[model samples]
Target chain A: MKKLLDDPAQAVTDSLRGFGLAHADQISVHTEPNFVTRAGGTPAGQVAVISGGGSGHEPLHAGFVGAGMLDAAVPGEVFTSPTPDQVLAAVQAADAGAGVLLIVKNYTGDVLNFETAAELAEAEGIEVASVLVNDDVAVEDSLYTAGRRGVAGTLVVEKVAGAAAARGASLAEVAALAERVVAGVRSMGVALTACTVPHVGRPSFDLADDEVEIGIGIHGEPGRQRVQAAGASDITRRLVDSVLDDIDLAAGARVLLFVNGMGGTPASELYVVYGVARQMLADQGVEVVRSLVGSYVTSLEMQGVSVTVAVLDDELLELWDAPVRTPALTW
Target chain B: MKKLLDDPAQAVTDSLRGFGLAHADQISVHTEPNFVTRAGGTPAGQVAVISGGGSGHEPLHAGFVGAGMLDAAVPGEVFTSPTPDQVLAAVQAADAGAGVLLIVKNYTGDVLNFETAAELAEAEGIEVASVLVNDDVAVEDSLYTAGRRGVAGTLVVEKVAGAAAARGASLAEVAALAERVVAGVRSMGVALTACTVPHVGRPSFDLADDEVEIGIGIHGEPGRQRVQAAGASDITRRLVDSVLDDIDLAAGARVLLFVNGMGGTPASELYVVYGVARQMLADQGVEVVRSLVGSYVTSLEMQGVSVTVAVLDDELLELWDAPVRTPALTW
Candidate 1:
């Protein structure tokens, strides 16, 4: 596979080294255990928010670490879950005596590892709470996940919960807010091309040029269906319909519509998808109160897009609108 | 070619529709003589900063069209220059009583059209100044440009100039600052794969599986040479060396090192490149006081990157740090 990397085994470490250097003012990277923490450490007596998973979906856990977001982010090798020790270290480093909140995606490996880490942190006399995010509406079970996979909607969970934590909420309050977000958010994706894992040096799956996978997962897992390639509007309609049908939103429900690009898609195409999706929601009488369109959570240069809709209450909207300062996301 | 588009011809218009819808709070979209302007129009007596070019390199012209940046941006068809009429319309819409400044990339079509637009605005009794950006250090001449082709460094110019204009700099002062940026900045890129323009339906150039083009232009124009694929460090070293060599920098020079991803490359790869480039600069005694990473300027899903080094004086540094609130960039 053609990739800009050195030793395939060193991809994660090398990239993290660079990441720490480029964003030194915002975060500090810890080796050995491998976790990134806020530069000045978590504020005293503030509930620390932490998240992690595989490394490929960049700007996800790591990029979101800063003032109003993750206090620490632990990254595993590309497409592989971080070890329990890594997560425990992140928890220890981030806890500032107010406790910690862990946002774990529903993947089996991630859930187990983070749970183990939480247990380990609790044993050390530190308060800890864990919330599972399973927002993907595509499938009931996947190769790597037992429940619905956590795709782009993980971003919504992190953003809302991070805001709560940043405002000095307790661990229980932040955990409750995260669970509320998980209940309100839903996501679905389509892949035009598969991404290759650096170590494997081959595409994770094979997709014919004239076909597209609908409801695809971030790790190239099997999706709900595969169909002949179609135009943007038709493809977008399928995604929007599936997501809306699954969510129990009423006619006047207000929501945040996020159109996220899976690595390789350009901003122009993302905008096109956003316009089509926005109109589709409006036709259903759903008011799109806030919008996010960009490549935030991705699948290692995979050419695709994911549509996420999160029902926004007044409190949720306030949290979403709260100021956030991070490397990948800032306002 | 696999792309997220409908009728290839509608790519620009459709994408703009989505962009306008997604960012209605920040900017307004105008059709017929298509252009994008700040939502509330330019502030009276404030010098208007405007820029435009082909459509493919997104977030360059349009994404930078909010507060503290461009007052207006015009987009042409993919890889094609904006017509003189379109540029004229943008200038007219963005101009307040303080006149306007046009930032043009050093391309044959872009230069001619923007110049024509300036003359047209002058005929209408509006003061206008133009600055040409030719920062690419790849070749003295290229297929679409008479001299060096403008590449990623155009961002530095627009950002610095836009900040000046926002701070109420005169038309002449903004123009002069833009020119100074042009003189101090230099950039070079490497393309791992070619991109397919929507209407063209074919890769811009051909390359073997194990080949890479060094010193490449944004439009897939031939670069300095094609060599066997190498690891990230080797490739990044070549790019950093070429840019530093072209610009005359002393040992203690302070610069802004920008590592921009061509659309298809992932963030992981970009930081790898940034880390390498930053170290190389440090080894040469040049301090990277500021950094901007990610895909700001892109060549429609091309998998590659460009390194931009701009000498920053106290004034330029202050301007670079000025608040900018656009869709793609905000602080």
Candidate 2:
């Protein structure tokens, strides 16, 4: 309830205006359609990469738009999916002669809307491909998702796929690379506190001071279990175990590790979690090839952390290391 | 206090272990003296830049250690100043016979400890120069200091000064550039709620359900005043006005605007503040040459925002745009 905002209804639109101004050198905003496209128009023969979901997850889709990442990002209201029309506008704005790729999270509404948008774009003779990111290992099914929740790994997908697109990959090649990245990655999260949607004016869930939710989704949906709060090491072990269980990796497998913060968690704690998780992976004889630690996908003010591990091959590692100039994931 | 940590006493050291492991390619950790130094040592003739302070304001000193930034960082216990021995160790590790520059915040404890360290280093024949950043316009003095508290502007100092040092500036030159950056910058912040230090296990201060602390310090130190909670625009106006008053700017002045989140606030809200801040600056006819909107300097889980504006000339602007590969501020 203590959020900084003028009106809850205006939060998404107003924030986008701010994003446009702050990153004017790298992005342009389409006010009417509520999408952000690359400031410089797409190259004539490079595949356009577009991604979006709800707005509360900062720097996910919007902040990732730039030279080596997303071409366009269409954000909806906080925790609400964008309409098909909005997604179509983003596609049209980002499309050059090459093609367009829609990077959709596995959320039911997001999948439906983005599919509709892809169909609309195809009808207009714009070649398009689509991929779903369902890397969250938290639950088999969730309140708003059909199969699995797309959590922090969406960022991994966007980064690798964006790099591929930037390298002039065709629509089919970019979508295939995105799917491979999705299949190779798994993520799990835990929340010590629930987040309040600005419009709701209350936390989405209630928990006692000493309780914690393990395997939680980004939207405060119930995870696999809620238990008494544990220390950073124990919590990290649980999330890492969950992710490791879902992924197939041999001993000595090199992987990329991502430790994502759930908004309110400080970087110090995230590092603590990272230390524990890295130790855990080392114990399992898996080599961490690369690591990213920070708030990439966040649930608004939820205090927690998510651990993601993406099995990395030489090609995938090369793509991950490829220069990215997005606001959040530049390197 | 609900923090993600195994032991409150070991938080700082344990977190650094993770930082070292995660950024092993770029940094190396010295556990005994408790400092992080660049894994790839400083260039033979490059002046080494080092910074440090309390542990909780993460990604400040530690995350800024790498190429084009701090050569070393010494972290103390949470909200506590590091010992002179620790700072001296960092200075020694980073010193490559070219000299060393210590960037200290304006907190009394930090200044005292860093000064002691400088004397220690000089006695060891390492030429040392120190610069104090006190750019907070919140008050003339605060709970922990005799003068203005160094807040978000410290990042600007580290960035520009570190760039100068990377360019092989002499110790005197780096120190002078850091001082100039401090003089050119002013910042103000507001806290929506008090933060709980893990060891303290309680909120630092109390506020009513509908109250806010204006001009708040990063350590939750008392600021100018508290008042009934206001909308983001009104609050942004108050903070922007305070910073604007303390700095000299003509109508056509070009400045770099930084809107930082104090840990728990979501990026959406930070952008709201940024949008308002950018508009206010434009209304005053000040052109924003560059803008950084994120949680660069943060209080631990305190919900709030801080605004900083640094007057920029061609030299400072060029340095600001120089490539930086720190863990946090990479571009």
Candidate 3:
């Protein structure tokens, strides 16, 4: 594999070391039991928000750790769930007097691990609440997930929930806000190429040159269908249709349309997909009031795109627009 | 070629439409002699700062058009320079009562076309000054350039110069600042795979499975060497050595170290490269006071990375820290 890595075994630790160094003013990295917490520990009397998953899909949990987003992020090995101890460490390090909220993606491993961590934290007399994110409309169950897998919409959940916490919401309020975002958001992805995990030293799947996978999961799990490669608009239509069909929106509903790159796709292509998806929503009389277009969440270097539609009310819009500063996201 | 594109011919236009739509609050796209201008137009007395080049590099010229950045940006066809007419249109649209400054990369076509546009703008009674950026240390001359090719360091020039213009510096002052940045900055890149132009229907260059092209140009041009693939640390060391060797920096020099991904690389890998590069600089007694790590400048889905080091004074540091709000970058 032609990846820029030192020992594949040391990939996560080394990358985290670099991440911490690059954003030293914003975050502090903890080894031994790997986790990252905001440089200035969580403030007193404010709910602490945290999230994590596999390592390859970067700028997700860890990159979002800062003043207005995640208070801490626990990172597992590439494409593997973080252990219970790792998550527990993050919780202990981040919790202030206001308590803590864990935003767990809906994968089976992630769910079980974060649950264990929450229990562990509670045993230590720390108040903890967990909200599961299952926003992907692509598949009901996949390789690592027993339900709709959390995908790009995880970013929306973290941002809105983090903003609520930053605004001094209680633990219950933050957890509820996260679940609200999970309910309002839906995402679907397509993969043009499979990504190679460094340790595996090969692509997760073999896709024919003229083929594309629709409704693919973030970890290269099988999608809903495999089909012939088509034009950008045709591919985009499939994703937009799946997401729009899953969400119940009225003619005047307002939303945030996010076009995310799977990884290797260029920004120009992401914008093209964004334009097509925006127009499709407009045709359905749904107004796209807020938009995000970039590769905030990705599967290593997979070349594809995911379209996320989040039904937004005034409250959600205000939270999204709230000032945020993180390595991966800021406003 | 597997790419997210409609007709290859419409790639630039379609993408620009989406960009303008996505950032309507920040920029306005103009066609028929296409260019992008600040949404509110350049301030009445602030010298207008503008930059442009071939289109595949998204978030470069176009993405940086905002309040604290470029007043306008001209984009050309993929891998081709913008026409003189296109540059002239941007100059006309962005010129405030003060003047306009064009930041041109050192590529021959960009230099010639921008020169013609400056002349045309001057003939129309608008003041114009041009700054040429040639920061790539990979080579002295190549297929598309007469001197060292400008690469990621172009970002350093545009950002610092744009900030100066935003602060109401005169055209001369902005141009001089841009030149100062060009003189202090140096960059070098390595590509693991060649990027295919959409219309080309094939990779720009072929490489064996275990080989890498060192010091490759953004356009897939020949570089300093092609060698067997190596670990991230070794590759980063080579790039750092070349950049540090080309520039004379004594102990205790303060610099901004930017590690930019060439589109297809992941953030994790970029950070891996960043960590190694930063450590090497520290070993040499050069302190990295400011850091930028991402795909701000890129080739079209080229799987590679570039390292840029720009010496900074207090003035440049202040300008770099100045608030910038754009689609691709914000602070």
Cα lDDT tens digits, model 3, B222-243, are 9999999999999999899999
Candidate 3 stretches greater than 4 Å from native: none
lDDT tens digits by residue: candidate 2, B220-327: 999999988989999999999998988889999999999999998999999999999999999999999999999888888889999999988898998898989988
Candidate 3 collision pairs: none
Clashing pairs in 2: none
- Candidate 2: regions farther than 4 A off: none
Give the higher-TM-score candidate: 2 or 3. Answer: 3
Better model by lDDT, 1 or 2?
Answer: 1
Cα lDDT of model 3 by residue, A147-196, tens digit = 89999999999999889999998899888888888989999999999999
User: Candidate 1: what is its chain A TM-score?
Assistant: 0.99
Q: How many backbone clashes does candidate 1 have?
A: 0
The model with the greatest DockQ is 3
Docking outcome class, model 2 = high
What lDDT tens digits, residue by residue, belong to model 2 across residues A89-186? 99998999799988898999999999999999999999999988999998988999999989888888888888998888888999999999998999
lDDT of candidate 2 at residue B149, scale 0 to 100: 91
Q: Which regions of candidate 1 deviate over 4 angstroms?
A: none
The chain A TM-scores for the candidates, taken one by one, are 0.99, 0.99, 0.99
**Whole-model lDDT, candidate 3?**
0.93
lDDT string for model 1 (A1-331, tens) is 7788988899999999999999999999999978999999999999999999999999898999998889999999899899999999999999999999999888999999999999999999999999898989899999999989988999999999889988988889999999999999999999999999999999999999899999999999999999998989999999999999899999999999999999999999999999999999999999999999999999999999999999999999999999999999998
Model 2, CA-based lDDT: 0.91
